[model samples]
Target: MMQELRSRKVEESSAREDVHTAASGDQVSTESGGRTDQLRTSGWAAEGPSRPWCRPPPCFSPSSDVEVWLNRLNDYFAANEVPQDKWVAVLKSFVSDEVYVVLAEEGPTATFNELAACLKKRYGSGESELMTWMRFARRRQCPTESLEEFADPFGLCNAAQTFQRFIDEILHGLNFAYAFIDDILIASKTPSEHDGHLRELLQRLTNYGVVINVDKCVFGAPQVEFLGFLICPEGIKPLPTKVQAVLDYPLPKTYQELRRFLAMLNFYRKFLPVLHERQQEGRPPSTTSRRSRHRSLRKV
Candidate 1:
């Protein structure tokens, strides 16, 4: 506490360099679909007519250049007698926007100009080169960078029906880092009131063969250390990082020391609520035990 809030900031926020990818598509019809009226009443509990692939049913495997990979997916399904939910999930990872556009453009074999125009109209920047976009999506299937955001034109958080539709946008050549995060971290809990999001997470984890260390874990326990933070029941407490920050903190014997400590925990003050008001910044928090009280002796 006293040593380092006064030192230099450690985690400096640097501007990320202007960064990268490419995609092509026409202006996507952002209009509400035929089912809009039915889906509007309740959150996700609304009753609706059944439709293939739009409902919770497994997505159909389409023939494409990706068929080789798809075959492996089929084998996995056959090899594992997982629950229906997990089965449904692995199946969902197949279809993607790149697949759709590739099949669409290849069959009709539209002129480059037409394809570009359609892509631009549907996908703005993606229209400049539809094939390029498709290849890029295939080449880099990492969901975040792909066109998933574009698929739902109208973002619907609870729409399982839309999951296939949205996922189709970026299901190819998947980068899958976030997928790992989803399995290991996000899904390792009980279902919340939010339509069993926890179940969905764990379900996905099951598909990926991801396991949670139960003894090391706090099942449904709020505030476990993940990647290094106390993700609490209440909210993200980040206990490990805070302790680290304090332990790693420099002494504030000088004015500079205060700034350094501030930099370390500036983003974390909410968790370290005691901060200055509680006079918690005097000693290094990690090593704090008993305060040495000085007895003032009066000359008799």
Candidate 2:
């Protein structure tokens, strides 16, 4: 009986040991799997992550606008988070073979900004400010031309300035009416006052030889839509349609899409109090942040 009891006790102890060993193995396996997942997600695994991609800008040509082309190229690089070291190579890939030869003749460029400056010097319009002002000052109506034809001067790169000056001249000393580019807003407390104001504005425009597009004109509106906002006697507010469009936007899956999403949010940020904070939460880490994280992982 004593021998049998001792044997039973030995068997129980062995069973407990076996269970403990199995549990320990499982714990080790789970820890290893967790570490592997961490490495993969952080892009430090054997395969690493795929390089970011974006659509290349249109090829630069002699006839292309150099400043616009350079702007687009810069946007593409920023969208893809491309390293500065690859800028010259990427620029070379997007040019024609002839343009490529020209760039080669200039020798290797040390930086993207230097290459851009070289392109601007070689291909830009190079119009001086004094020449532009002189052209503006010398503008005049031809004998056979209509008022519209006379007002629109050709080769004037600063059309916005021309429009602003024209509007300011026509609306000078008008207290009740204000003009923004082509849109005019006439404010009055009563219908009679509004009628007077409108007629006065129309007369002034007529005197300046400016013709209004009747289709685009709104007459004495109590509430009006202007520049994506609804203006009423109450206050200005974002259009419901615009708000709905924002709500309907799908989750961004690419860098370009993310940028567009952020831009949309920024436009209405005045209405959204916490929008800036929310945007920061989703923003990708900067290059500096990524490098710091990499250093930390190396230490680990």
Candidate 3:
């Protein structure tokens, strides 16, 4: 019994020693391998913990102050010509269920002035009955008719009726839109679904020979960059391009041209309204100070 007890004690001592040796071995290996380089680094921290001491702060927000940081970052990206190729991928994964829409309607027979006016009223500067007519005039397989002929103001059930088969099957559950000067795109999950919407829109646009850039297209992201601005699956953010486009716009050389621009900015009233009225009235915005002018015009 005495011999057996002694043996058990010895065994336990050996086990403890082995555990100590193993831990000691790891420490020695870490210290020995660590290279001392000229570059400054948290070398002590590197050897210390398996986990980091602190996580990085979040990178973005909605305030104008935060915009300064983003502008710098975006500027770096733009100046480098480093195509934000991965940007699309990041946005796709971020907002996976969003969709973007583009509408392309053809002119069946309306002349430049009348069709142009209808386009303005229905889809242009204001969302009026005429504006709704723009939606009808551009919808997929929309019937060919003069704006005057439509009994329904919006035209979902007017001269150009919404096709039951198309809407019931496709575009049933998609939201989000991106409108260019003459066309609009509806974005969503499964390029296949979007394709269905596109086919209808394009059929009309094809008659007009309008070309769409498929490369800039994306689907199934919780967030996406559209018309050079970020739109989430649920939220709407007007692209910087949309706003900048307004600011950089040149004063028209003629009264008619001024009317055209007025028609254009009429829809952007929320962003800059009374001032927009001034611009519409033919006052040239001086390059030195648009902001002050914008403020002055607002007071007026």
lDDT of 1 by residue, 127-203 (tens): 34533432222221111111111111122222223223222322223322112111233222223432244455445
**Candidate 3, residues 1-300: lDDT per residue as tens digits?**
864765565456545655775777743223212232211142111121132111111112222111111221232121212122343343444354555553443213322333345445534554244434333332111011111221112212222322212122232343333333333446556667766765665564444333445554443445555545566765545576777887899866554565577677665454454765576444545563656544544443
How much is 233 displaced in model 3, in angstroms?
6.6
Q: Estimate each model's TM-score.
A: 0.27, 0.47, 0.25
**Cα lDDT of model 3 overall?**
0.40
Question: Residue 212 in model 3: shift from native, Å?
Answer: 14
Worst 10 residues of 1 by lDDT: 97-106
Best by lDDT: 2
- Candidate 1 runs further than 4 Å off: 1-122, 125-223, 226-228, 234-236, 244-248, 253-257, 272-300
Clashing pairs in 2: none
Supply every candidate's count of residue pairs whose N, Cα or C atoms clash at under 3 angstroms. Answer: 43, 0, 24
The parts of candidate 2 lying over 4 Å away from their true place are: 1-148, 153-155, 288-300
Evaluate residue 12 in candidate 2 and report its C-alpha lDDT on the 0 to 100 scale: 62
| Model 3 residue 221 CA deviation in Å | 3.0
CA lDDT of every candidate: 0.31, 0.46, 0.40
